[model samples]
Target: MKRKVVIAGGTGFIGQYFNDRLAKSGYEVHIISRLNNHIMWKDHHGIVAALDGADMLINLAGKSVNCRYTDKNKDEILKSRTETTKILSTAMLACENPPPLWINASTATIYRHAEDRPMTEAGGELGEGFSVDVGKAWEQAFFNFKLEGTRRVALRMAIVLGSGGGAIEPYQNMVRFGLGGKQGSGKQMFSWIHIEDLYRIVLFMRDHENLSGIFNASAPVPVSNSDMMASMRRAMNRKAGLPAAKWMLQMGAAALGTETELILKSRWVVPERLEQAGFKFQYETLDQALAEIVKS
Candidate 1:
């Protein structure tokens, strides 16, 4: 029988990408999402059945943090992540033959905003505020589960760049429109990973049974906002672009219905554990990743 994989909340950008990869890799892909067509989140029995005898279970369920942080949005953001995770844990517990590997989604935003140094799994400092708190709670919910039969890994993913629709499109458009000079001081570090590499890390973790717990799913190379914008401009063949100041960014963010923190936060995260585990990134540099993405 072909290997089976279950993806909770697998209807978004990352999930769609992974679904294609899994299908090509000959694994039977299953999705438990909020959508009514497939197995819904409220359908507990369906989820239990999907988890049984699966190779891996990747939970990427959560509300998007791209909106204004209203009280209602914040509450939904926190509950969406923790509640879905709790449900998955219960489903895992009910599985007669649970997936050998369960990789829950996490964010690099868990680490404090640092212009000082790169945040590693062993050395990173946890940040405060709503975003950081959400990351903490999400991880806590996953780690709260104790199962001897299955290995649990929390993938602290950085901003994922890919040919498919993701955060890259908006940034690309910014660069094309000549507003890509750099937001804020432009000195803040921008940590990111190719979506392909992010996918590969999941396979590496699943194959390497010794690996568990937290792993920073970012590239070894992290560039600054200025450098990234420069690369974007080069990729798009734009010579000069305008810069957005902190106050300007605030107005722009409000108008766009998004948060400036997504652009302003200095996420200097590195995939130390993944590298130490001998996992190599296909696109190690921003230019390399951007080149591939822009062409596609």
Candidate 2:
């Protein structure tokens, strides 16, 4: 009798990785997604049925925020996260035997753009405006419902680095094209986690029953933008990187149809709770994580 794990909106980048890890761990994995073969999100009956006998539920359903933050895109970004989470909450509350543990995806951007200090789960100062509002709203919707037996955890993840997908490839491409340099001031902090470690963190929360509430999912060692770009060059065997100024980033982001915030935001986050819980990170530092990813 293997434990069943249902992933709501589990067809995206992080979801796919989690799905693979869960399946390999011998959990009977079921995906409630938009795919025709899986349980569709709109299929109310199917959602309820999926939640009925689950041991765990991990929801990673949301639109990518890699593009330009137009008004329409902003609305969709907020709605996609909040609404999908709401639906899962609705379904979970209705279940007599709901998942004992429920983990939802969250962003580290909820914290203020701080260069002076690192943001932790306990004492981090939250930011304001569009991105911050979105993060706050997403978490708000997730914790709004109270299921009797369910222990809820929101994973406030930083930029997840890996070989197959995520922020690594684009940077690699930039390095290859000789455009890899520290963007803007190069003083902004960049916090990140290896994807493999991310997998372990999820399991850690699931296995540790007492662990509940928001946890920042970033590596302990965050580096400056210049240092990261230099490391990227070293990993790629490149000699020099052309630095991009603030104006250049603005123009480039506009031309590329993406938001500058993705590059400009100083995400100085640290996983204090996870470490304090005795969860060891395989790639705790940026260079080590990058080396492994570059080789892969």
Candidate 3:
């Protein structure tokens, strides 16, 4: 029998990449989603069956925070994370042979907007505000589960850059349209990881049985917003670009149906634990990641 691996929320950008990669690697990759295909989130018995004797379970089930944080969105964003987490945990509890490894999705934004220092697993401080609060509650729901049979890990991820449809595409469009210049003050730190590296980190943790708990999944070297914009411009062969002021960004964000914090926040995160465990990142710098992503 093939090894079974379950991915919750396997329809999003990151989830699609993981599903494709794992399926190609010959594992029986099953998805637990709200969609009718594969396994539905409402199907408790289906989920329990999927988790039965599975090798790994990766939960990425959360509503997108890309839109405006209205009251309805906020409620949905919180429930989508916490409720889905509880449902999964409850199913795992019902299984006689639960998955050995459970990797839950968390965000690097859980840490404060630090400009003076970088946040790491060993020394990072949690931040306040709506996004941070959601992250805290999400992790709390996952960790509150008493699953002695499974090794749990909460991957605090940074902004993921990749080809086609992620952070890179918009920047590419901006550089093409001459809006590639920095947003707001442009001094805010931008912490990011190559999508491939994020996938590798999951496999790395699976291989290293000793590794468990919270680990920040970001590139070792984070750049400022100005630097990130400059790198994007360079990769796309653009010379001069238009910088957006805070007010302009606010307007743009409102028009684009997204929040400005996604662009303006200083997220200086480092993968301290991954490095200490001897996991080498494929794309260590933003330039390297942007170069390949732009090429594609």
- lDDT (Cα, 0-100) at 77 in candidate 3: 98
RMSD of 1: 0.9
Q: For residues 184-280, could you state the per-residue lDDT of candidate 1 as single tens digits?
A: 9999999999999999999998889999999999999999999999999999888899998999999989999999999999999998888899998
- Model 1 spans > 4 angstroms off: none
Cα lDDT tens digits for candidate 3, 1-296? 89899999999999999999999998999999978777998999999999998999999999999999999999999999999999999999999999999999999999999999999998999999999999999999999888897999999999998887867777788889989898999999999999999999999989999989999999999999999999988888899899999999899899999999999889999999999999999999999998888873
Q: Which of candidates 1 and 2 reaches a greater lDDT?
A: 1
Number of clashes recorded per candidate: 1, 0, 0
lDDT of each: 0.93, 0.90, 0.93
Please give the lDDT score for candidate 3: 0.93
- Give the root-mean-square deviation of each candidate in angstroms: 0.9, 1.1, 0.9
Clashing pairs in 2: none
Minimum summed lDDT over a 10-residue window in model 3 is located at 164-173
Model 2: ten consecutive residues of lowest lDDT: 287-296
What value does the lDDT take at residue 231 in candidate 1? Answer: 93
Question: What are the clashing pairs of model 1?
Answer: 178-242
Question: Which stretches in model 3 have alpha-carbon errors above 4 Å?
Answer: none
